[model samples]
Target: MEENNLIKKCQRGDKEAFQKLISQYHPIVHKFLVKITNHEQTAEDLTQETFLKIIRNIEKFDIEGKAKFSTYVITIAKNAYIDYLRREKRAMQNTPIPENLNIEDVHIQVEETVVNKLYGQSILENLEGLSEEQKIAIKLKYIEGLTLKEIGDQLNLETKTVKSRIHNGIVRLRKQLEKGDER
Candidate 1:
């Protein structure tokens, strides 16, 4: 059977069909994540995330559209990478710097200011690069943890449009992060 037909079957709650979809797309997902995070473990974990997300949201896949089902699944993988990076950066920051290092004594105020300024600048630049719809979708969905339907109601878009915007936003953010401007 054709892949799209398999996807349609999976969307309709066929468990075996879902497995076939996973088998076909898992490698593509892993490779996509490796391109973003450059870590084998991260890519493997993200591949699992992508498949799991697809399983959970298979009904949302537009098997009838020109957009391939694999594209939709990989988009989830890309968003997972962005979410991972943001979490990593926040974790790094929340770890307290050692007071005994005496680095704080020498340049405490200056270092803190520089770090904050750089971080702010990088985030602003990346946000500016995103489309208004993408930025809004990401902010609402990821930051606010709003459901897609809620986001749609708030933004006056279809739920699928909200998901697509969030997916596209994360893909663009992954590209930015891979460029190594980790501020």
Candidate 2:
């Protein structure tokens, strides 16, 4: 059956349709999660969670919507991963440091974490200054660790186009970052 028909069946509360839909999209979604999280087990958990949310919200998905179904699924997967990251960050914040750790060692670790956070924040801010096309390309390539071919497929662009965007974006970012450093 076509995707629209499958989605229609899913919307009508067809269990078999939902299962088929999951089977169809699970691999790409799982691969994306694995790339973004860099952890296979976490990717598996997030992939499962993403599909569960999809099952719950399938009725709301419009067959007439502009986004392709694949895009929709990827978006849901991204949001699920983001939510997981937030929960993990909160858990880290709430957890007490181990008593076995030396005070100076803990202090050094905390300092390193803070510096990393600041540098990461600056990169994110700079990313906002990029064109939407370049920003997406750069994030998928560097942050999510997706290959050029994967990014091209996801964005429906040529591999050459994706590579050019990433390279140019990085050059611009490097210039911007150097200016900031000099200040």
Model 2 CA lDDT for position 155: 72
Provide the lowest-lDDT 10-residue window in model 1.
30-39
Model 2 residue pairs with clashes: none
lDDT of 2 by residue, 1-183 (tens): 399999999999999999899999999899888766667999999999999999999988888986678877887887787788679879989999787988899799878866875777667767757765687688889877789997877776789999999999888988887887776
**Which candidate tops lDDT?**
2
lDDT of 1 by residue, 66-104 (tens): 555555665677677677767887999999977677765
Q: Estimate each model's TM-score.
A: 0.53, 0.64
- Model 1 has how many clashing residue pairs? 0
